[model samples]
Target: MISFSPTEEQQMIVSMAKQFASGEMRKIYRQCDENGAIPEGVIDTAWKMGLTSSSIPEEYGGPGGEHSAITGSLIAEELAWGDLSMAMHILCPALFAYPILEMGTESQRKKYLPLFSDEKYKAATSGLIEPRFGFDPYSLSTTARLDGNEYVLNGEKCYVPLAAEADLLLVYAAEDGTSHAFIVERDTKGLEIGEREKNMGIRALTTYELSLKNCHVPKENLLGDPRGYDFNRIMNCSRVALSAMAVGVAKAAMEYSRDYAKERVAFGEPIGSRQTVAFMLAEMAIEIDATRLMTWEAAWKLDRKEEATKEASLVKTYADDMVLMVTDRGVQILGGHGYVREHPVELWLRNGRGFATFDGMAIV
Candidate 1:
């Protein structure tokens, strides 16, 4: 018995998110992309929406509410619909806070959770993707070795969002052939912050390369209990979130192209009336719907505390293909206009290309 409808509360959040996306994010996305930075005002405005605060318990100095992956997925889709890079920037804190809330020790939660729940938006991020070809999360190039009561970390992490000003970083590495997340403070010795990466897409989001040279942290910094937290679960949440983002980006491209095709006339006929254009739009719509359903299903399973490894992987793989296909079709439909910088279809296509490596950019 599976229900695909959103709850009342979920609907409300989705509506609010959609408004924010359409009004604020869409208005400034291009400028930010060209500038290679999201304005602080834009981020602060989203923060006031209580995206992070509402999830924390009242006991932890937040407006009490449950953290639902389905709701998060809904919200994420709308936000990314406005702009992918800004959406990632707005949600970066979750990359650090959600993992702690999900599997951190009681003390860890008490220490770190409140930071996110505070009145102002806090900069916190995660480091997972390493600088190497054929990177795998399960088989990390980064290594963590226990020495006495502390763990020593040795690795280079790339594409870490908000790394320049992030107060806290949840660095993932392999220890005894198992993935583990370590909470490292920004000022920790031997942890060097590299220059901001000039990425192919999502350029508005500030990402950096990091060099960890014999960095050490107390055993308490390890997330979860002695048995260790479920790394797979975290990865699943990340996949679902990324899948939702792909849906948003694809949806935006589809709608824009659809509208363009209807209005643009060639030889006194709307291009959309032609069979080839109509069929391509139809296929794009079908692919987007299929991918959205898969993403929502994975998010639903995650909210119920069920294993969603397969579903998450399925949606991620499907979305990886769907977004590229849809955006490419959008560019094709728009002809010369799509290739120009004034139009967003090319930008969407560029952002959509990074779906293959979007592992730790988001979490739910």
Candidate 2:
């Protein structure tokens, strides 16, 4: 099984995230769910705790975290156990932050990095997908044409989380039929944001439609690779984090089911006394164990700087499905209580349905 036993530093981070999440973030979870609003300070506390910057390097005044794929996953799992949306929001900056730190020019980093920590600026999102299709970025329809010192971008992107609240967009656009990435500030000419999408799951995260009507971006905003940018690598690096979130949701389901079974009465006694009920819990344990092993293997491969695309793909796909089974069973064990809006299990199931959607985890 994938071992989650953390090292001294890893354990310390886990404990810190666990403590804070159980306290502050836990209280606000349902509030955000009910109101579909994430408080402004949600990301601040994570940043202050250094958990949000766990993937960033020290050169950028960050925690100097070594890009260990497993470590970040561990952190994500812990934070997500309390609330998935909050966990995602805390780590969302990495989507944009990573590309800049890895590929941005000194001038680019100096200008954009400072905005991340500044509450006045809010956050920036990585806009890579298009309305044309999902998962495959190669199907991009956006065009970026060089015009003197700047590039003019025209295209629309959809389903990007944080697009509504982003101050800048790290968008992927085509340059002479070659894929290139552009960092378009929100105020850029002809840049427009459509209405927030009404999604069934992860409602706290507001997805948006980005319209760039011949938008003009400065020359310096481009990152590395003049040719088409590689979305596979970006998605691969993010796989571990996604698995960790699933782990968190699964862990929550397991614990909730166990406790509910123990207390819930049945025909003869508490449901926990039933052999059939015990068997279901046993199955959950098995899936969780297998998924953990796979997730860690993928993370270790990434830490060793090896190609983990297949391993990550395998884990993300199975883990998402496993969480659905586990959570659905949790609801079954809860009987009427699980289906009611008063319980969190129903919400967990709704949120879980999409975990397998993004990044092409479905039947791929």
- In terms of lDDT, which candidate is strongest? 1
The per-model lDDT (C-alpha) reads 0.91, 0.74
Candidate 1 residue-wise lDDT, 1-364, digit = tens: 7687898998899999999999999999999989998889989999999986788877767787889888888988999999999888889999999988888999998999888887688999999999999999999989999999999999999999999889999999999988999999999898999999998899898999999999989989998995548899999999999999999999999999999999999989999999999999999999999999999999889999999999999999999999999999899999999999899999999999999887975468
* lDDT for residue 1 in candidate 1, whole number 0-100: 73
Please write out the lDDT profile of model 2 over residues 188-275, one tens digit for every residue. 8898888987777777777778889978888878875443234455667666667778878777878888898899887868998898
Off by over 4 Å in 1: none
lDDT for 69 in candidate 1 is 86
